[model samples]
Target: MSLRRLLRTDAAALIAAHRASVALHRSWVTPCLDQAGFEAWFSRTLAEDYLSLIALERGSGAVVGVFNASQISRGNFLSAYLGYYACVPYAGRGLMREALPQAIAYLFGEIGLHRIEANIQPGNAASIALARGAGFRLEGFSPRYLRIDGVWQDHERWALLADEAGF
Candidate 1:
């Protein structure tokens, strides 16, 4: 597996995955970025306290997923929100299981963040399992915590601290 910062070169692959995974992600939050929107989003993303990356299969060069440390906050409360999705072909194959630990290490060790949180809809068992496998603890649940697909959806808050993330 390989991971790199998302670039214009990755736009097409990202869009394809986004489109293909619509059903899997429909109930999750997203901005539905097309190629142009992706370019625009990338142009503004880093400046807005977010870092996005693409994960690729080692030899095939096929994108396996996307990962992001979004809404970063520094100073005494160094932390960020974690977001990610595995491609249709790679989902349930433990690709995220491999990618997440690396991403978390990057956020905690390189980015110097003390905590990273992933809020997932309760019904997304796969996501919840992924978070748990990566050592995230279920902190609580929020009713209508976020508006996903125009509906206020509930989310279970999961988090891993720098010290506990097994980095």
Candidate 2:
């Protein structure tokens, strides 16, 4: 697998991946997001200067996973937040393990960010594990950080510094 910047031509493939990811996340979150909302979100993401990478199957060009760093700032305290999801079939395949570091390098090295953080639902063990695998350190929990499945949910905060990320 290889990680690359998302291109305009990838819109449809990304849409498909978003649909799969949303469906999978629906079981765990509230006020599930719809395709229209996803489209708007994706469009806005693509327009950002922050990095957005996609894990593609080299041979088939299939987008198996998507990860992004948004809200980047380059002042003395440079920082950016991360978000990611993988297609159901790609889950547990260690694809994120490979893609995340690459994306981190771009964010911290090329993009000159000093810190990166991931916010995950408290019970989302899979995501928590992924953040740990990517060298993120658990920080603290936030109450009602996000609205999910129609209810406010608490989330755990995880962060990694540029040097600590080993990128």
Candidate 3:
């Protein structure tokens, strides 16, 4: 798998992929970016606070998933939150396990961030396992941490620091 930075030419494919993967992301209330939404949403100049990258199968050139690092803070708290979803065709294929280390490398080594956090719902064993496999440790729990699927949901905080990631 190869990581592709989101580009202007990917808008249509992203929309289609997102539509196909909607069911998988319903637990997170992820927005499906239509053309207009994509226009407003795909601004590339905000690297300081947000970053979006797509995982692609090298030979097939097919999109595997999208990984986002957002809410980045650079001051005393140098960290960001991760949000992601696997494309329908690539779900359960261990694409994340292959892609996350690369994402973590960019966040910690290139972005110069100290930590990357992923908040997961308790019942999402798959997601929790993904985080654990990527070397994120459970940090804490928050009640009503986020609004997912129109309801407040509890979440387990998971994080990986730069030093721990071999930065």
Best by lDDT: 3
Score each candidate by Cα lDDT: 0.83, 0.76, 0.84
Better of 2 and 3 by TM-score: 3
What's the CA error at residue 119 for candidate 3, in Å? 0.6
Off by over 4 Å in 1: 31-33
Best of the two (1, 2) by TM-score? 1
Error of 2 at 52 (Å): 2.2
| TM-score, structure 3 vs. true | 0.92
Model 2 off-target regions past 4 Å?
27-39, 46-50
- The total number of steric clashes, by the backbone 3 Å criterion, in model 3 comes to 0
Error of 3 at 155 (Å): 0.9
Candidate no. 2 TM-score: 0.85
Q: What tens-digit string does per-residue lDDT give for candidate 1 at 6-91?
A: 78777888888777877767776463459777877688565758998788888998878888778899899998999888877888
What local lDDT score does residue 5 receive in model 2, on the 0 to 100 scale? 75
Clashing residue pairs, backbone N/CA/C < 3 A, model 1: none
Give lDDT tens digits, candidate 2, residues 51-116: 667889778888778777778766787998888777767888888777778788888888788899
By the lDDT metric, which is better: model 1 or model 3? 3
Candidate 3 segments exceeding 4 Å error = 44-47
